[model samples]
Target: MRLTRGGKQNAKGAGQEMGGPDKEKLVPPAEGTAVPNGEETAVPKAAEPGPVTEEDRTRSEEGKSAGEGGQEETALAQEDGQRRPDESSLRSQLEAVQAELKSALDQAKEFEERAASLQAERDEWAEKAKIAYEQFLRARSDLDGFRKRTERDLEDRINRGKADLILALLEVLDNFDRALEAAQKTGSAQAEGVQGAYASADSSASGQALQSFIRGVQMIRRQFFETLAREGVEEIPSPVGKPMDPSLHDAVAAQEGGGEHGTVVAELRKGYLYKGMVLRPTRVKVIR
Candidate 1:
């Protein structure tokens, strides 16, 4: 096999050592002659340089790879020494970021809890307002009812008072009627029994006085009836000569008379109505 210059030198040095022969004492044997015992063979001259073989190319690649590997190892060691402080700085930055994140999380949790508490308070206030509104509605309804009832009661009391007062006044009216009838009868009888012109004149003067009194009484009755009319009190129609109605008249007595059966003959006492209600029933005599 062919070798490079360095490989050839190493091989020559090894051959010299193994041959144990000095180059000066070595002799070339003649052609076709046998060598003597213990004599070494002649060393041939080295061949000339030749084209590179596959083995030579492979060995050169191995040497270049070894040199590149050593350079890479040295660069890696330098990088490790330079990166120590940078790695420590990065670690500090990471720790600060983690602390900030933890603080933010805690604040968010506190805010969430506060928001929940506020919502609960709002709901409580809303419920209170709703209850108050319902109570107000109930109170308003009750007040309206009470007002209406009070008005009704006051109206009833007023009507009842008016009826009682008017009934008392009716008795006085009856007395006035009786007094006028008696006075008229007395005047007529006295006139019928008069004997002389002088007595007739005296009777006429007395009649004038009686007529004045009767006109005064009539004026008073007319005023009283006007006042009662203003207070919603009205006299019922006379039932005399008509069929007696139970609603308007009470039969005080029954008599045989020149009238239809169950017909009212006379009204003993006048009846009155107050505000469309019967205040008093007429007392009448009915024909049997």
Candidate 2:
């Protein structure tokens, strides 16, 4: 058999020319230029220069960021400088406002305290005035009571004096009546004639003459009796043939021709009372 040159061969018998190209010796293309069919070529570009390695790219980015950061920091510093004085002015104004508010609160507290003190003083004065007024009213009431008591005492004294005078006058009248009765019983001609003459005269003329003669005495007696009557003086019940009451009557002696043991034959003297109080008891003759 005839063997060709391109025939499959064993690894041990293969020549050095049969191996693949060396990858380690291969070259890359130059900047901005395309490689030819099988050869690498280099070309320059007009754009900005690119980083040659990883470390060069990182350093270029850091420089660009640092420049931008420096410009921003300058602007922020200017803005802060502009606002600092205004902030200080605002803080000063706030402090002044707080001081004014504190002063106003203090003044208000002082006014409230003064008002409370005034109100307390007014209440105290009102209480004192009320007490004084009550005292004045009590004094007036006491004065009125004293005046009434004094008036009552004076009236009682006057009444007692008038009652006593009236009693004396009544006794005198009783005696005169007895004298007249005795004269009537004696009845002598001369005495009868004199009595008749006295009776026949005009009663008005004789009464006027008698009243004139005893003017002073009668006037005193009449006034005394009127005063006693005004003071509630009164005569006790007395009539002919009435039964005698031991409580109101003074028995002088036993009488004849009476109906029973308690019979009142005659009244010797009248009884009197002042305001339900017995002034004098009736003197009488009672049948046994």
Mind sharing the TM-score for model 2? 0.51
Per-residue accuracy of model 1 over 86-147 as CA lDDT, tens digit each: 99999999999999999999999999999999999999999999999999999999999999
Q: Give the whole-model CA lDDT for all candidates, comma-separated.
A: 0.83, 0.68
lDDT of 2 by residue, 1-288 (tens): 122222222221333234432223434765776566867544333222222444444555676678799989999999999999999999999999999999999999999999999999999999999999999999999999999988889877886786687678668756555554454344333344446445655654555554454554555556655766786877788844778877788888786664877788888887888788777888888887
- Count of backbone clashes for each model? 0, 1
Stretches > 4 Å off in candidate 2: 1-101, 175-233, 239-265, 275-277, 286-288
Instruction: Give the clashing residue pairs of candidate 1, or none.
Output: none
Which residue pairs overlap in candidate 2's backbone?
30-42
What's the distance in Å from true for residue 244, model 1? 3.4
| C-alpha positional error of residue 134 in candidate 1 after TM-score superposition, expressed in Å | 3.1
Error of 2 at 208 (Å): 18
Q: Candidate 2's C-alpha lDDT?
A: 0.68
